[model samples]
Structure formats: structure tokens, C-alpha cells
Target: MLSSWLLVACGPSQEPPENSSLTLLHPNNPSSDTETYQTENDFDLLVSDYESTQRVIWQKPDLVIAQLGDLSGKTVADIGAGTGYFAFRLVPRAERVIAIDIDQRFINFMDSIKVRLPENVQDRFETRLGKPEDPLLKPSEADVVMLVNTYCFLENRIQYLKTLATGMKNEGELLIIDFKKNNLPVGPPTELKVSTAQVKAELEQAGFKVKKTDNQSLDYQYIIVATLQKPTNKIN
Candidate 1:
């Protein structure tokens, strides 16, 4: 057993709605950011859904893919994969894409969409309900682990990073794309934004070595490619 502290950003209670498919959860992952975000009811109306047009301009998904290097025959875990925004892009390139979200609603939404997608696309992707602390993925199973705009919201992020590496292969990479600390036209509140240097320092403390960083790849955010400083060093 990893830990019982898994949870969403502002997650569901220990027991989700009686009708919910989410039976594996504990509490919300605590964070120091004081800003507020969406709720369960908000998701029902697709409030969490990303805007494709804006994403094309701001996130530049295509550029992000190019930066990731080769994905052929790779296994990627898209942590906090809201509505499988990036997972859809990964499934076509990677051998497998495991979409994990603490919100079961997101997983269910992905399931609904997955059913309508082509069989080949469906075969390349999977959805798993995750806890805030644990991604619930097998040990050393992924070649690439990614998080897009998901880092600032996690509680005990340092601990989560320590736990996150367990799911990556010895030489695997961890990619994070998040909002910059500066004020932006579109993004989370300023207080919630985390600087790239801050993330780098935190990851370094958690036993990850920052390999590359690109500030211009995304309009309002930055990307970091880090490799696990392997040899199986676990943080106490």
C-alpha cells in the first residue's frame, strides 16, 4: 500500500455520491494556494473542459509534442488528465496512455468519450481514478509521465513527486507544463501560479534532475523535462 492521502485538488469526500463510480478516494489534496476552482456540479456542465481554439494558441499542443521527443511505443501517464485533454494527443503517438485524475467524473467523462472514439484509439488509452497522494500506477511502468497545469494544485507536491517516480522506468522522463508566476490574460489566479525556478528547486529536492526547460514553447506557461535521478533513492 502506498498511502491513503490521495485526493483531487478540491476533491470529493471519502465516499463519493452514492451513484458515483468513484469508490477509491480519501480527501482533497491540500495546497497553500488560496484561490478557488471548480466543483463537481461545475463538471456536469463541462466547466472543466479545455477550449480547443484557445489551447491551439496558448498551449500549442503540437509544439509540446515535438518537444517531448519520440513517443513511439512509449507508455505515458497523464496525471490530472482533465477530460483527457492531452491524453487524446498521446494515444495517437504513444503505445499506451494511462489517464489518471482524482476526480472520477473526469475519468467517467473520458470513458464516455472513449466509447465513441475509434476502436484503435480506444485500445491505446485507459482511465484510472487516482488519489491525491498516489497515481495508483504500477512500479516502473511508464516511459513518460506528464502533468499539464496540474502541479500548482497538488497538496504535499514534494511527497507526490517522490511517489510519482515509482511509476516511471529507470531512465524515464517526467514532463510538467504549468502557468507562469506572472499575471496572464488567461490562467489560474496570480497567487496560485508557480514559477519555473520554484518547480525546479522542488523537483531537485525530490530527487529529480531538470534536464530541459522551455519558456517560449507555451504562451502563458512553461515546460520542464526532468529525469528521475535513479538508483532507487526514496525520500524519507
Candidate 2:
């Protein structure tokens, strides 16, 4: 079992009202809930609202997809896939896409939307109910696992990465996209924001090698591509 101590970052807690559309779930403290600024029952609503308001501040999905190069026939996992937006995009590019989220409500929402997806791409997308600390993907299964705008909510960063690593095949890649701490007002609370260096350090400590880091069009976020390095041979 992975240790809980590996989780890092903490934030204020607030109870979400029954009718509240948005709820923030933190991985470090699973029992606590936080109310978000917006209220939207469906993840698509949140995505659409963000895109509309932050058109200049949001990263272009197509550009990000381009950075990933050729993914055809590759199995990818979208961790913390709140609305399956990224997963849907990956469906046509990747051989398979496992969209995982911790919230049952969100999973239900994904399932509901899955019905409307084109028949040809529908078979490539799969949904899974996941936990904050564990993504629930099978060991050595995915060629790539992506955490987009969602890594800050995690408490046990190392454990979470380890769990993800377990599900990744050798040489698998992990792509992380999150807001930069200095780019205030664009993401969560300032204190809860994570810097690229911080993310790189945490991932490195979790046994991943930083392959590339690039600034994203989003006002204060970056995209990092990291890969697990093979162990070096040791002298007997």
C-alpha cells in the first residue's frame, strides 16, 4: 500500500450546499469538502463556462494535442477527468481512453454524455470511478496518463504518482497541466497553486524523469511531459 504521507498541499474546507453545482474534493483530506466559486451540476457546463470566460486565458486543446505527437493505437488514461472533455478528444487519437474521476456524480455525467458521442469513437472511451489517491487503472496498462488542471487538489503527490506509475507500462509518459503560482486569479486559491518546479520535483521524487516543460497559452499554467526512466544497471 502507498503511504499517505506522500500526499502534499492542503487547503481551506467548506461544506457544499445540497443544490450546489460545484464542489472541490481534495486528495489530501478526503473527508473535507470545499465550495467552488461557480455552481454547475454538469462538468461540461464548467468547461464551457471556463472556455467562454477565459478564451484568452485557456490553452487550446488542439495545440496541446499536437504536442503529444502521434497517439494512434496508444492507450491513454485521463486522470481526474471531471467531464471527459479531454477523453473525448483522445478517443479519435488514442486506441483507447480510460476516463477516471473520483466523483460518482461526475462519472454518471460522463456516462450520460457517452451516449451522445459518435458511434465510431464511443467504443474507444471508457469510464471508471476513481479515488483521489488512486486512479483505479490496471497495473502496467496505459501508455500515457494525463493530469490536466487537477494536480493541485491531490494531497499525497508521491503516492498518487506511484499509483499512476503502477498502472503505466514501461516507458509510459505522464503529462501534467496546471496553473503557475504567480498567475493569480486564474486558478484556485493562491496558496493552493503549484509551480512547475514544484511539480517537477514531486514527480522526480516519485521516479519520473522530466522530459519536457513548456509554457501554455493559459494565463498562468504550464504543460509538462514526463516519462518513467528505466533503472540503471548496477554492478553485481
**Whole-model lDDT per candidate:** 0.73, 0.71
Q: What lDDT tens digits, residue by residue, belong to model 2 across residues 1-236?
A: 11011011211122224554223333233443443323333344354433342232255777777767889889999988876767777888899999998877667878988999888777888999987779988978899988987898887898889878989988999999887877353455556778888999999999999999987554457899999865657999
Q: lDDT of model 1 at residue 101?
A: 91
Q: Candidate 2 — which residues are off by over 4 angstroms?
A: 1-57, 230-236
lDDT of 1 by residue, 159-195 (tens): 8998988888887899999878886655555776689
The per-prediction tally of clashing pairs is 5, 4
**In candidate 2, where is summed lDDT lowest over 10 consecutive residues?**
1-10
Per-model TM against the reference:
0.80, 0.78
Off by over 4 Å in 1: 1-40, 44-49, 232-236
